[model samples]
Target chain A: MDEFSFIDSIKQKYYKQPTLLKGVGDDAAVFRQQNKDIVTSVDTMVENVHFAKYTMSPFHAGYRALAANISDLAAMGAVPAFYLVSIVIPADLSNEDAGSIFSGMESLASLYRMDLIGGDTVSGKELSISITVIGYTEPGRARYRSSARQGDLVFVTGSLGDSQAGFHILANKGEYEEESYFIERHRMPSPRVDFAAKLSGIKRVSLNDISDGLANEVNEIADASQVTIILNEKDLPVSPQYPQFPVDLQHKWKLYGGEDFELVGTVAEDDWESVKEAASNTDTVVTPIGYVAERSLSSKVYLITDNGKIPLYSEGYTHLK
Target chain B: MDEFSFIDSIKQKYYKQPTLLKGVGDDAAVFRQQNKDIVTSVDTMVENVHFAKYTMSPFHAGYRALAANISDLAAMGAVPAFYLVSIVIPADLSNEDAGSIFSGMESLASLYRMDLIGGDTVSGKELSISITVIGYTEPGRARYRSSARQGDLVFVTGSLGDSQAGFHILANKGEYEEESYFIERHRMPSPRVDFAAKLSGIKRVSLNDISDGLANEVNEIADASQVTIILNEKDLPVSPQYPQFPVDLQHKWKLYGGEDFELVGTVAEDDWESVKEAASNTDTVVTPIGYVAERSLSSKVYLITDNGKIPLYSEGYTHLK
Candidate 1:
């Protein structure tokens, strides 16, 4: 099988969108951008840097690429529309492995109902996959982390630190039976599209998807909006999957771990009840871990721990550069 | 400067489009796609394989990435609007080298008035760049290469053989003075977007950008349209810059060289005069090179050289895997 066959496999599995005038098999894709505001993000995942073939299947790695991109769109409350993928298939890649990757990407695309419009596949020494996800948001209603205001209540969707715990389990080659959830959390975390869509209806929502850990995302929102975030460490949400790890490691992963695909944001205190009403009837669990405070020139992020208060830094998941 | 600095530098040089609801510095860029069909394409360039830092600066390499994507849009007669770039920068790359690449991209961006909407920067062993260009075409009017009719006249914009010759000159490290034109053709080939826009007004137009050598592109159109294409060697437009190479090398490069960024297309015999008039005022030089013939199951492409008619195969620049 060659590159064209690889494309054929993708085409066979893609969900055709009404707006797609032309999909794969052209020099470029043709699509109609239904008169709406478009949300776009690009992310690249290198073989070893993002995932290892030994730790997870190629299927999981490919799935992670789209998951990460869709997370960005979800943060803005955009509906996934179309995506273009470019893959540098490594020379040593087995056909079975490559097929697994495409199949994995197909699974995510079908789940999200987004069309795989255009992509390029080329041979290279190291495998890298870059995806450009296109989605649409309601014009002025798209949420941004930079809009958080003082006295707003800080909140997050779903459990935190699950991805890091999953990494720990896999790194130690834990028993297969007990590790599936953790592994899925780390390798196949889905974007909070439904949850974000639910909350996006409210106007005071300021959101950022947590890819680089909760602390880092908090710092980003605080710095962007020129506010201080005070998080109660005891209030941090951790998955039931973390019982196997020691308390210290669990806290470490919970506070500084990344790739969780959870979302962190701020909403006005008066609108919290409305957001809770919107969040109801969804799979996601909402938690208020902190509150937005007036800007402090000394420190932007702080955690209220059992031992006392501590400043939080953006030290989560720095890639090997 | 670090990767963030690189981003800041790009932010400083980018143009904000009126359709862009939000530009860079967000999780995902937001834009309003006017009610038109969008043409999208992605390309990745790897270091050493696509360009050498010795012969060309990092700026030119970065510039070439966007130029290549714009060329694909030009072929479809789409107006270049927005683009996103993802770079896997190698660690050994100096800050200056990285700066040069961004500046190079900025120059092209300013020239085209296309917004640099979003991008990502990460560390990898080899420097690789991927660009996705988004443009718009009047619905149902975007030119596709799969519409050439039998008996249609084939035409190409600008000269060929120059990029390959420029490659040869650089490969051999010949003096820099006399080879500047050829080298520039190789390193900084501009997309013929304006030229394509002029001819796209004609209905008989079936266009393909000449990234893969002209012969290969001809084969694509013929195969897609179920027709045969025969090239007249005497009519082949070799750039005057090719006198440096011997006759045989010149012919080989002209017939099989790639990265030309020229437009190869066909027009009905009745529409040739109108097309010529449309092309005259443009800076591009349009030349008639061949004509489409009724499909034959046996052969798809043939070259009418002085020696004899020969079957043409795709022998364009093959990247090293």
Candidate 2:
């Protein structure tokens, strides 16, 4: 269980790249990406901070860290190229166990053509993983968060909060194999790269990955654009099992529970049909969740309910808090 | 003590850049580097791992995390451009203390021209800081560790083991105010950016930042290049305080103790004098430490001492052993 062996196992299990000039054994991972703008971002997952170690699988832990960072690149309409992972694992953990974590990360990186460039592995009291993803966007075509306007229609790429439901089911150890869909959603949420890449200029208003629940992320776009967000409760996409919950629970899960890796974005009114058509070709549905309004520079976000427009508190999983 | 407050404090204290498209608050920091070869590296500092939390000041902790990453860029002959810091702090710490950590990082970034880009802050059981630095090198001039040849003379910038001595003094609370030079060397080692920039076209044998002790790093370069390195112990540079150490302790600390952020490199034997002269103008002295030797392909590093040639073992710090 030495550092070199742990790193070797990771390299054998995960690092498969033709572009890497040098991989895990070197001081740095060297890569070359041509004809596109390189987009880079980093995300750190810590034990008892981002996740509880005993409650989550090491594979899922590894996958989630990479997925979260890839999602940031996806939000920018970039193709993930490579990643550097700095891991601080507990000293007691054997190299075999560490290899499991790295195996999971390497698998994801291989799947996405992400060359494992360089990372530092150190001993710590708990597990902490910091992954920095480097991606590329076509010249002058990267979508940004400042592009949303007053009249754009908001849309979400996939169903929300299934990951949260998965968390609850796994935590309770509820005996329901029928809940596999939600369980997998929570454990291994996909970063919407393919869906986002094709979503170039038309629906390329303000965009963010739905991580801190739709309610909070939607508000983030609204707050950033300095506009009012009107969320249509009926249009909010939910998993098939969502209705099985009581009304209050469903609302609570949909609004506050986090870890949904869907894409929440906005599109212009006239371009909505084409955006939907393009998304349809990818076998993914884009549901209209809301519309933008003139600046609602207030502390409140709201849901348009049948009863009336009611205040929707923007409270999701606050990692910092 | 809230997350927003913590972020606000960092924004006010550290994130000041006129060209920063988005700084601390956004999902990612955006900026444009001149279309030069973009050089990037990442380094992490962990509590009770990289530094003992009880012993290391939060400000030095913060400064060192950034400095280590910046040093990587310096080794690559790149200019400091931008950095993203991901900090995982224990919830028990206050917001103002968090501000001070960032304030320390800001002072270094401002001095080095590294803009504080976007970062993620989270509550964890222990403190951890990961910094990713992005810099630019003129096209095709970025130095690497694989470029050394058989006839190259190994060179080191500045004296080694000063940081280790500083560590000893600091640990014992030794009165070393008269030895301020060594203390500063340990507290803050300068990255040789200006000197490295001028060393272009000199065809360096290999280049690396010396943090994990000279012997260990020289072994790394030799291991990577499949060459034997021969070092003369008598020729090694020692700071003025070297005589204060008992002989064995001096050699042990100089050879194995880590955290000296200097450059260990190799150059053509013919270019040795010019390289030394160039380093002199930068107010840093470069000394020849060793020579690349032709050895059995399987031979490890060797050192020539008064006793005889002995295998050089890497007894430095390992992250997850």
Whole-model lDDT values for every prediction: 0.82, 0.74
Residue-level lDDT of model 2, residues A1-321, one tens digit each, is: 676666665664455555444455544444444456666777888876777665567887888888888888888777787788888888676676677777778667777777777787777777889988877666555667667787898888888778877777777765654488987887787888887777665645567887787788877777777777788888888877777656886777777777777888888899888778768877777899888877666634579999999867677466422
Per-residue lDDT for B113-224 in model 2, tens only? 7777667787677888888887766666667776667878988888888887876776676566446677666667677777777776575547888778888888878876
Top candidate when judged by DockQ against the true structure:
1
Candidate 2 has an fnat equal to 0.22
Model 2 alpha-carbon drift over 4 Å, by segment: A12-21, A53-55, A173-177, A201-204, A296-300, A316-321, B12-22, B31-35, B175-177, B318-321
DockQ, Cα level, model 1:
0.71
Which candidate leads in TM-score? 1
Estimate, for each residue in A1-321, the C-alpha lDDT of model 1 and write its tens digit.
Answer: 876677777675445677777777667888886757778889999977887777778999888888999999999888898888988887799888887887788789788788888888877668899999988777677888788888998998888888877777778764644587888888899898888887766887889998888888899888788888899988888776566688898877887788898889899999998778767856778999999888765439989988898888877466422
Fnat of each candidate:
0.71, 0.22
User: How accurate locally is residue B195 in candidate 1, as Cα lDDT from 0 to 100?
Assistant: 74
Candidate 1 TM-score to native: 0.94
lDDT string, candidate 1, B1-321, tens digits: 766777887675445567777788778988786767888988888887777776678989988888999998998888898889998888799878887887788788777789888898877778888999988887776887788888899999888888888878877865544588888888888898887777756775888988878888888888778788988989988766566588898887777778888989998999898778877867678899999888665438888989999888765457422
